[model samples]
Target: MSATGPAGRVQPARPGDPSHIGPYRIAGRLGAGGMGTVHAGVASDGMRVAVKVIHPEQAQEAEFRARFRREVELSSRVTGPHLVPLLAADPDAPTPWLATAYVPGPTLNQHVLAHGPLTEGNLYAFAAATAQALAAVHAAGVVHRDVKPQNVLLTPAGPRMLDFGIAHAADGTSVTRTGVMTGTPGWISPEQYRRGTAGPAGDLFAWGALVAYAATGRLPFGSGAPDVVAFRVMSGEADLDGVPAALRRTLEKALAQEPGDRPSAAEAAQECVTLLASQATQVVGADAVPATAVDMVTALWDVPAGEDPAWHLPPDRSPSRKRLIGAVVLAAGVIGGLAGGVAALLPGSTGGGTHTSSSTASVPPSSSTGSARPLASTAKDDKDGTAANRQASNGGSATAESWALTRTAQGAGEHDVARAVLHDEGVVAQELGDGVGFSPKSVRFQESRREVYLSYTLASDEEGAMYAETEIARNMCLTVRDVVLRLHPDLPYRTYVMVKEESGRDPQVTWQDDFVANSRCRSAADDDSAQDSGTDQDSGADQGWQPDEDGLGQAMIPSTDGAEIRVADGAARKIIAGTNGIRRTLGTDRVLGNAEIKVGFDPGNSVMYVWSDYLEWNQEQVESWADLAAGEACRALVRERESAGSAWPYSRYAVAEIGGSGYLMIRSGTATTRAACPA
Candidate 1:
């Protein structure tokens, strides 16, 4: 991490800028915000960091200084694996500053503008990564309060959420004055706009909007003057013209007007991961670079003396989530920065729903298949095909081209067909319109029997939504019929609308069988299906060899006489048993899954792969057990080895599959390499 960083490449530090802050030698500048300038600085150790220094004028104010110190204290609390971990800080210094881990990449806004929207694979990875980051943030009990595209940074591993100056726990004190509206204008939630307190729910709304921008190159609510955009957001009038089909349902709930209607960050992440599995959104090539991190910027939305509050570096498209704190400056990320563009290649779009958020129905289990194509966009399906035709004739801007409907072959299996419909929000929203607005709750697309079904609570389920429920169902039926007939005109287009018992999970889960299960899908796309979403981790990913007919795989074996057998499991096991070479241990037996990686633990901890059957437990039962014991396993490993060596802190984490055995292994670190346990 150098004093002068990549961000400094854009603009050099001004003549008046300080040459050093603490041990960091100032090089150039990242950017300036209302609070202070963020410069690229290098420590004597040659570590590069983004240094935020407060302005002298503000530093003189005790109240402002207090806020800055508070922000630094709170910011230090957020130390997620991918977060911009705080490197150094000196709030009491004559010129106060804070340094953060510097990531090398463009912001999401810049990446999109330069690359013209992400591919379906990149988008899923992007969503998954952001969701993971948010999960960590929310788990820490801190509300980011602001999350938008500009704040997202695109890197090789995935997206990381940046900035925490203003982030605070819901149970903690509020950073901004009460009644002050703080946040980006267009991306803020209705509750926040009305000055209501928001939690993770509000951030979810911004996440949906950010995804929309990534896919359509436009905000869900078309960009407009502040008042207009705010009105549209409050009114649930989203402009989801070109978003892809698969993602609409999830995004709809995420963007629901009610803060309570959005899925938890973890749930949203699972949806993205699963949807990607269905869509086969895997890395496309050797050169493929996965995106990482969110953007940050600063802006002020004013309220009168009796009134409100307000809130990048990326682009107006600028860096999205502005840093919450900086020296005399109460906040960081003063704008006017570099960043990009509009390209549509996504799953869905919507205005919102009145439904309350609910947990997903039990996911049967993990699964995969690639025979899928994105469900066609519904913007073209509006009004009995008239608009679709017009748009196509006019070059498909509002229809197919922007959405980029992947061509489908005949008889794409029931599995593939179910995926297209269940995943695509544009198709669902357009087909099921105003009277029948329905946000997706849970959808299961079974390949067998060509069945695609998921439960749904009405979009609102409030008085307005209930009153229109009947009509919504009627319209939903009509649209489903038309959509079915259009896609599988020759095959049996069977769609049944049923009402099922309420699960009582949400008050809004009003109707039984509130879902419409339809199958017009005839076949999976050919070329896409051929690409493997993942190879067996044992053979391909981990660079391990598959066992031969007799179970002799690639390994190295040496006997006492110095005799050796090449590619022998004996040799491999012996080699792994030693500490100097392979970092992790190889399972001695083939009973468990050949490849098992541990997750959620610090490195340098020992672990052993165990079979569920050996313990008389089923895979499901053991999986749950492993999750609960992952941390303990590392601690135990450290404890058991304490007499032998010093127990350093555990740091390694990964999710590994226990061999073919029913149980999956979840451990922290290798026993031989990761222990510093005391005797």
Candidate 2:
């Protein structure tokens, strides 16, 4: 069975065509579109498959080719029964084609068209399955940017989601066009059309609209041209005429225009499944529950216990169960601090009781007894305070400093605190927002060897805004900054103080700069000596020094001639003089240390440095250098705070690296304030 091309054109059946894709063989053609053509292929074993081939015209576009590659990559990373499994793909071929596990059934659109509106049972099943699929896709950090009835396959097994060609990663990706809209007009969310940012919630909105279509056999936003449908979506109007009352609330919430207001896919699935069970009870009358009903009841009851709190079950029974178990185990292992309830549900467990010999106690048997640890425990912890502070006045070279800021009744003192901190550190600081109405405050600071940013929110009078208010604000701010510094111990940057002012006006902000300047800073100040070696590669040294590897620190040294450098308790070593290749090793003996890479020429002239955590390189030094260089472009760095079941030491970091210097630095702060830079 060969693949089909655009407009339902059939490609010649070749020797490689095994008459199947996953479980289905080529039976005939179903349809075609501008993107690809679908062929009715069958699985060699016994199931049916749908194979899609890129249109000749689309295949010619480099952008389309990149998107196609991403589709394959994302599909390969996710596993769920409700999601059409990518059985095969050959993106490198002149005519790229992808084959998915055959789902022997009509699309939701076709089914609704042929059989009128779906029954309550079918609709509930559809909702649960779709939500589960969306949850799985989102967990993998990818959003199904295109979700609609035409892309949903209704099979005896359940509703299987197909086509993720336009999926986008939540962390952001470079492949997508900046402002392109992708997906069916009637079913798309407003966010998708407006900012072109489709996250997990956007998919939920589409799911709600899709459910409405299944129930009433009409578009949720009413029948209209693409433009009109888009207008309705943007306006937050959804027609839910025939939707069941049990699902009305859930649908309404899911269809909310604001992304944060929508229920997560897992929550939606649970709601749907619960409703279906309740409906089944009503239909069966007062008679004894049937075996099928009993099984479903068992599954429903065991869902929370057997699955991860984050686990979402697809409509398909087998795969959903597998995912549930996997999620349960993974969640349990990482959240040990909170796994007491879950530990009791393991197999062959004994009841909780005291043991006389001081041995570890075992848990009782139950569905939830796997483990109860958080996922973040797996990462290594890096201490944020100085070694001297950590060791309490030891004779070691390490010294630690701590700064505090407090806001008074006045507006948020974030900017003031930021400026003070940066000034004390001898680094530049910039205030974000025109310093208006409860906006968060930010400051950039630089020492002779490092630069960092500290961001904190002020308390607002409103009850809802108090979380960002008061003494807790300073604590929270410091905690976030400390976590980031700990993760990248090698980086020179450190955020020491975060304060909330109680005064109505901006509070006083203060900081301390380095008492001793390094050789790098001294060399950067000399021009005549630096310019004498005009040929020196480091001759372009800028006053703005680039951060070193690990995004924790900065390095400033003469870029003129290579020189021998010595470190505390370390042998002197000769490094290249003129080139930009200066390597700094991190976390060698103590928690942190400073190193220098001598550039041959004087460092007075301004130089541009680039730093990025994502830079690709094979050599260790080069990779770290690249990270330092790329960090310059970032405005701030944020690390995930520990939660009930997770301890993230370094979930994410926002950094700002000087664009041209190949210098990189990481600071603790919010991503919202980071200035957009070219990819």
TM-scores for candidates 1 onward, in order: 0.40, 0.39
Error of model 1, residue 624, in angstroms: 69
Model 1: per-residue Cα lDDT over 211-304, one tens digit each? 8777776666654223334556776877666666777787888899888778998899778766555434243332332232221100010111
- Candidate 1's clash total is 100
- lDDT tens digits, residue span 1-679, model 2: 0111121223334222334332234554443322334455543344334455544433444555677777567656766656665555666556566655442454566567667777656666677767777887778777776577766766545666765533331111111111122455566677766666777888899889888888889878764223334555776778898788888889999999999999998898888767767655666543643344223433322111111122111122223212111110111122212111110100000111011111121211111111111111111341232221333223221122322222211112222233223221111111111121222233433343243333333323333222222212222223223223322344444333232223342332211112122222221122323222222123222223332332222112111110111110011011111113332252122221111221111111212222222222334545444344323222211111212113311212223323222433333221222332111
Off by over 4 Å in 1: 1-10, 165-181, 279-679
| Weakest ten-residue segment in model 1 by summed lDDT | 339-348
lDDT against the true structure, per candidate, is: 0.41, 0.39
